[model samples]
Target: MIIVHDRKDVRHEFDVPEGKALMLQLRPKKIGIIGLCNGNAACGTCHVYVEKEWLDRLPDPDEYEAEMLDEVAERRENSRLACQIEYRADLDGLEMTVAHRS
Candidate 1:
């Protein structure tokens, strides 16, 4: 179960199957992520702030994702592109908030 919060602070919870990335899991759910670049990490539309407890649990973003993240107006120490994170069983309870666009 991945828990997510929207810009309006609406809480959302859903099961994320393994093998698919986080963005793919989010888009179809209409959870408020834009994913404008379709998981390519080229746009910052899929930006999210990982929950503090789960921040260290996810893998570090690659250079490309890092660059995209830098472009997000709401970037923070916990910010990450959903496209860069793949689902894993260990991430069952991961939590994040969709980043607000500028």
Candidate 2:
């Protein structure tokens, strides 16, 4: 399951396919909130803040994602590019906020 804290409202999705990128999974449900780069790490629009406790559970951002993160004005210790994350069974309870675009 993926839980998103958006617009002061909480949303959840439980049927995400494993190995699908997080950005792709969020597209239909989240609409304009993320994935402006079409799942590529080209844009900073898909930035998100991973819950602190789940930070270590996720892999470190790749070079492309890292570059994008650095470009995001909202970048924080827990920030990540949704396009870089692959939904997996281990990430069932993952939670994050859709970051404001910079």
Candidate 3:
């Protein structure tokens, strides 16, 4: 269960299956998260900031995702592309803030 804090400050709890991408988990719920490239790691629409403690727990973004993230002005040290994050049991309590893209 990842607790996603949307840009509006609303908390959305989701049961993310192991091995699934975080973007897929949020899209069905219509939680204001949109992956314009459909999880291809080609778009920054699914940008989110993982809480500091959980940031290191996730895998580092790949070169493609890293390049895409650079396009987002709101990107931060803990910023990540949701489509690049795979779900895992240990990530149950993970919390992230949906980035407010212009």
Candidate 4:
């Protein structure tokens, strides 16, 4: 999967196998993702925005993901955390935008 930053045009790729958490894929790349609480859904620092085209491909966010996103400075319908999202083979080409907090 690859993540593209809208403003900077930066792109990151992960060699993720199915069933791995999206956050795990990002860690090895040192992509500046802040997975505070270690995937427990307690922090908003890991927020990212799924590209509109890829939104439906992802599972709906759970209650915790929703709550944490709400705390994000600029939450949007596509907003989610790298930690909260899991990867599947179908998401091999998935793209998302990293959302930075103020």
**lDDT tens digits by residue: candidate 1, 1-102:** 999999899999998789888898898878778788899999888889998899788888899998888788968999999989998999988999998887
| Preferred candidate (lDDT higher): 2 or 4 | 2
Query: Residue 54 in candidate 3 has what lDDT?
Result: 96
Tens-digit lDDT string for candidate 2 (1-102): 888877555666456889988888787785445677797888877788889999988999888888888888768999998888899899888988888764
Question: What's the CA RMSD for each of the models?
Answer: 0.8, 1.6, 0.9, 1.7
Candidate 3 structure quality by residue, lDDT tens digits, 32-75: 67998999988788899999999888878889998998888788
TM values, all candidates: 0.95, 0.89, 0.95, 0.88
- Which candidate should be chosen as best, given TM-score against the real structure? 1
Candidate 1's C-alpha runs over 4 A off are none
Model 1: lDDT of residue 18: 94
Candidate 4 whole-model C-alpha lDDT, 0 to 1 = 0.77
Worst lDDT run of 10 residues, candidate 4, spans 1-10
Off by over 4 Å in 2: none
lDDT of 2 at 91: 88
Which rank order by TM-score, best down to worst? 1, 3, 2, 4
Over 38-96, each residue of candidate 4 has an lDDT whose tens digit, in order, gives 88878876788888899888889899888888788888888988897888878778888
Q: Model 1, 37: alpha-carbon shift in Å?
A: 1.1
Clashes of 1: 0
TM-score of 1: 0.95
lDDT of 3 at 79: 90
